[model samples]
Target: MRISLMSTTLAQGVIDWSRDGHVLTAEQKKFYEREGYIVIRNVVPQYELDRYQKRFMEICKMKGVAQSMTVMRDMTIARSEYVPGEKAIMKVQDFGDDPILFDYCKYPAIVDTVKDLIGTPNSNLLAMHTMLINKPPDSGSLTSRHPMHQDLQYFPFRPADFICCSWTAMEKITRANGCLVVVPRTHKGPLLPHEYPKWEGGVNPMYHGIQSYDPKMPRLHVEMEAGDTVFFHPLLIHGSGTNRTNGFRKAISCHYANDDLCRYVDIDKNQEFTANEILDVARKRMKKYGMSEEEAKAVQIDFADIWRLRARAVNGVRQHL
Candidate 1:
């Protein structure tokens, strides 16, 4: 924890993230408050990780229909028959409807840490988003690099302080394998505007990134062993490197919030910019599959509506998303 102790916050009775004694130790909380993230070693056992990996592989192989799951194809390999099944996929997002995959969100080890970070000791929990990311070896196109962006940009929720993301390494993650790169303490800042980067190789669908960031900001590459889980703030500026290794890099993650304490927020003009982009993708998908324009238009979906459709109760009662 690099943050200096403050007497002013105490004077104002405004103790926010740091608390002494919980699922997270005082030291861990202090580090998270200062760095916007904390890595918990060996939180998930190897066997459990194997299950998640197997399930992801099953989805990739098209073993069964994973209802409502969006399989984002890597733009570089999307049209090539050379790369089959799993090799062509970049991410499997919104898997909350899949029971086997959703098990990752229900694991006690992850739940406790999420509850601790969200300041909800024993309350209803909602999984706002779930993803199984597969970063394949870059083919000199730099398509594997995920641009640095805040998770909050895509979320329409109030009191951003109560939400966080938990990411688990399914295998050894190193800089060579495109491990997560984080800008520490950036979570304290406001959510900046986001837009798709103009990469020579196009980005995956809905892969919006912040337009600009401090070039001088130091980036910490988070290297982790298999089964290590990390919890981070929603506003933290983070992204992954390009996978230079031949092997594909795998990781699973979920954005969590205390549903009992959270409420949907209206998207302002700036947020609508990115929101419409996401909506356009969905609209195109519907029309591509032969849905008439009038029929697709009748569907009526918004940024908040999309989240409401995805948000599911991970723990406790789900009164509202």
Candidate 2:
């Protein structure tokens, strides 16, 4: 299919968006504006899909964790009786240490898409943290679920509008398979504070009462196949239900910010948290890791290095450049 680029020519003294057209279709822009999210289907290739699947499975086996989502498969339709083993360990966040995962996030198509969405090519890398939510069949493991929250709420940054998230589905995601559900049009309002009581110990808390512009409106479920990806506004309320299809639902999620958007502001409180905050926090955390305070304080937060370490990652050669 031929996708047309909307030549909304960037004027002098104005931002130029023409370069990122491949990923950001004219129609997708409208969807983003109206609904606060957009889904791009079949963006990842079949071979790339298989390649990552094999790698993830191998990693799971190495870590002695559940390799598939089979254990929690029955939870989608009804409560499942299963528990997870103790050997499960999350990999992929530090994927840069692994060449295969690092190259995968750097795929041309993926980067181009991110460029289109971001409207710039010089956008540096964000950390490509990978995760494998492996649940064995009928093991009575606590179901993995995400609370309906915006990315900017947890992310300390400014401008609140420039950052974007790339979610690449590695496993076939469905309603029964536990895909993401988003509250459409919620990205325009102020961020809300959240504190939920423990719904069940060892399980993520049941979050409620985040400030919403339209709580009465219905929620939108985003069901996608492998290779499909969804990009949403930072403030778009989103989360996923439990995996009940008895298989693993693995995905690579990366967050990206424009290089020019240097100003960081807290989305909920609208308070500014500069790049200095990372310097301060990293220093403090280094102490716990057995580093001296002087050493930690001297650790600079390279925005480029930070992006490469923090942006999105999937199995294939795809990334946000």
Candidate 3:
């Protein structure tokens, strides 16, 4: 199915956005348009969640093989003290090459819902970013909090209406254990500037956040149960807090785009900071892979190329990222 989305008209300092539903019911579409997100009950089944958990453990134990995947340890644990690998690993990114983890991206329920929300035909849906997050216990470092930010801050794609994220709770998530917190209706506003939060201890690399926002804006703590999935717009301002509990808070997510509709854009004047930040990261990673500084500079991997490396078609034809 194909539908035109995101006609905008400004009024009273906010832009009104519109969408048409395919798999979504009338009420669900209405809710998403008003709140910037919708939580679908049990979109991920227990069996799939179990498999993901098991695969995560296997990777932690050094038994899984996914050369393209990256395992990120918590900043505190990475900088100090010896903890078992399983406890230190805080996230896994770009796991599309891992057979077990890749299944989450291809899952029909998820792919269809994402396609519906983005108003894109199933033949052109792509999963551009995937991450399995394990919010570790605070351990006094306070690094577990993902500061408030828009997912669009990290993306270079246009037609924000054609991009969405599917986040599934692998275990029950409550406010006490760092559930996702969102600013309602923030997606109706324009893209805002982002920078690393001025945290006292530290934050994980590339974890930039909105530097300023209205504190009085109503906050919604998204308490979710295992297997529950929330589909949200890329411009929605959301973040997770610290995990005060003893166990790791687990969730898996994929950011999907209408591959046929969304195309790369140069970072607008407003987003140059994040673009420079990403360029530094890309070059550093290149060095980690054995490229000399000059060699990495010569490669000229631009912003679009970085996303192209991560984009993988889940439900559709490959097209411009």
Candidate 4:
């Protein structure tokens, strides 16, 4: 593995897990500290998973949507003739408007565990980003394969350690179905520079990646069954392979933050920040929906504004961020 000096140095130190109400065992804490992630088997119940699965299909089958949820297409396959309409859907955002998804996000099993990892006694926990990813199979698109990168790149929040993600498998995940692949201990290193992938056919610039991925990093494929959840650090270098199977690989994930510890960074000065990339995406979507340039200009909002609307206090008290 090509280990940077900073990562190597951090790996040699121990992570402090001191907290008011931690639920992780010593071993689990150690694993997260050393590897920047942990998979808690069956953290979500099967009944809950079934509910979400059913709701997801219902949404997919709906004909006309009137603004409650945003359905995003796989940019890589959006222009392709092979995938059309809802079949091109890569993710469903702002689904929290649905009671089922909202309740699931606040489910004690998920909240308590997240609190253990990145919570504080005096503050609340916020669900910063929520989405249901559907990695379609047999589509000749790069959407199924995410480039190696850190989650923090897209987030404007400070103190990277205060942010984390809980990704739950809604169905069986395997290497053929694009299971998550992560590089251990990468979270301990500083946030590296990121740029949009320069693929010939084009890519979803919203999903930024490292300038160049080191092939020798200690990468691991994380396969899981339904109800299994993986909690990972925001800075962990991770991505997935293309789905070679005949079915879609489905997963629901929410990025969380310790509201007390996280605050938005000044994006205006940080021209390279990924928040700028996300804003560009929003503008493109607006234009794609047939909005005139003037119309888009009049209503355009930055990524932070969009995230504020999507965020919800899942535990303790609500925080204004």
Candidate 5:
């Protein structure tokens, strides 16, 4: 919550060599500065691009993960469809054990682009989650668009939106297939929240206590081509629409954060951020509200639970079953 921004260790390498045009051209840089996001077309070469996508699909099939039109890859989708007896999604964190996927993350182009945006050559892969949207020719599942919200809404530790994501297009992403849309310049303000979506019953993606945006905010849909990547501020609000086209939409989302000021926390709970190293920040916030110790502890425990669940979800390694 109130932690300092991630350190400049990673940022140092970036400033030494990067320019605005390598990933984001001058015009695009201007666009990003004004709007909060830029579409970096072909940040990844076609060859390396194909390698990662192919490896992920094989891992999915070997693990026996069901192919569904509606779910994204990564632990979130795997965990959502997880049966107690079955294997889960292939975690990219464990990619060290495999050569192909491991090499994919270390690709120079990817790292350079990250260095350009985050000002850090030492950037670590915060998360590597893939999404596969399969739709039939005529009939397919229809889900609501992801509510507009900032990535920083989930992780408040990073100083000012010093985060980046690259969603590689495995297949062509068209408007009919639900490409991502983002609000320009929305990242400059504090995060706004949306109503938590109740997927089936009450089980759904945790909103991380984010409230929806003001009704009058401006918005845009980011229509991207296959093999292109879009980068944005972590605080920028973004989401995609449902796939209405006949074909499937497949993409891998790679998240990165500044090494300094970044900490692993449960995004679902009301995490506390104290200015100093005080153990009683929670108690103090509660005291200001006249809450008894028991009530404070209850909130802390709930916050801790959400934090822990998300932690398990974050760095755990899941390979193909």
Candidate 6:
């Protein structure tokens, strides 16, 4: 997929600028508005990071070796052979079911900044998605290189500006360790066409990429230390490279939305929406649960329902039911 860049436009302001209790400085907000993303350094406490890392290992042990493949919040986890000695557990999706993971999502520094970006002091916020990614070194697959795409492609929400993502590094993230790369100001544009990347073996249908991404666009390599975080718009074009280094690169991320400001789109009738990947996952889950097509339809449970379940409220209240 290749997208051509035509012109750059400033992001349309969706923030409640009059709101108080904002933690971001004026300059930081300005930068975010201009670039569609902002990196906050050392916002996560070292102790918290360490605790979460330990908890991840503990969960891996609890899951046991026999549970090599487990699905959580749409992310797929598997044991990796790339790591020497002990096999490294690669967790790629939802961490909402875990208490420690939920704590990280509501971490004050993270949620405060999120409120500054997408909500007023009184606005309710929802933790829309969560993932704890462990990228194994030399995977030699698309698993490492996340193709550039907009997060909104999979979301069934409205008013993209009301949604944001907080991605925090659990350890030093460098280009060698597959740090994030983002196309600046891309969020100001509408969502582009998305398609599965051309890769051998089966690719996770949920992993969609922009059908057209122009290389000429202004791109940034977001390198960071442990506890550093980046809050980005849902429509921002971004992805990561391969971990060329010799160890596992780990990160925890969660998407957030102003629950009072966003609503669910009609996926079945919305011509502008492309959530085939998410729909496919819902279908598979239905089958796994022994739900026949008629039963699924009878209950009115499908991709949108699955996504709604994924959207858990971590702060204030959830407005969209």
| Residue-by-residue lDDT tens digits, candidate 2, 1-321 | 112211122212223333226556666666665687788888778788777667665564454332222112223323534323322432234454444545555667776766556445555534333343433222344345555676655455434455566777876787765688899987776666644323452343223324433445689889898888887767788877665666666676556554444233322332123233444544565786788878776776643344344444332333332
Candidate 5 C-alpha lDDT tens digits along 1-321: 333334233344344322454554556555655577777776567787578667665665554322211222322334355433112332332343345654544556665665566644444434332233232222232342454566654453444444666666656777787778787877766645445554442322332324545547677777777677777777777776666775556565555554442454433232332112123543555666688877876664443332222221122232210
lDDT of 6 by residue, 109-147 (tens): 898898888766677888878888877675455466777
| Model 6 worst lDDT window (10 residues) | 2-11
Question: Which pairs in model 1 have colliding backbones?
Answer: none
Looking at candidate 5, the ten consecutive residues that score lowest on lDDT are 312-321
Model 5 — TM-score against the truth?
0.62
| Tens digits of per-residue lDDT for model 4, 1-321 | 111122222222223564224567767777786799999999888899889877777777654443547777777566667654446777887676777776667877878777777754444888888888888884675556888898877666566777779999998999989999999999988777887777664665466778877878879999999989999998899988888998888899988887765666644333356776667667766888899888877885866676777778876766655
Q: Rank the candidates by lDDT, best first.
A: 3, 1, 4, 6, 2, 5
Which residue pairs collide, candidate 4? none
- Model 3 lDDT tens row, 14-93: 21224444567767867887889999988899999999999999888767757567888999889877778579799999
Off by over 4 Å in 3: 1-22, 120-123
Pitting candidate 1 against candidate 2, the one with the higher TM-score is 1
Once fitted onto the true fold, the runs of candidate 4 whose alpha carbons sit more than 4 angstroms away are: 1-22, 63-68, 80-86, 120-122, 140-142, 200-202, 268-273, 284-292, 298-300
Q: Each candidate's lDDT (Cα)?
A: 0.82, 0.54, 0.82, 0.75, 0.50, 0.73
What is the Å distance of residue 181 in model 6 from its true position? 0.3
Total clashes for model 2: 41
lDDT of 1 by residue, 1-321 (tens): 112221122212222455663578777877887788999999889998889888887888767645568887788888777667668778999999888889999999899887777655676889999999999999889989999988888887755666789999999999999999999999888788888889898786667788886757998999999999889988899998999999989999999977766677776455787788778877877887889998888887877778888898987788767
TM per prediction: 0.91, 0.67, 0.91, 0.85, 0.62, 0.83
Best by lDDT: 3
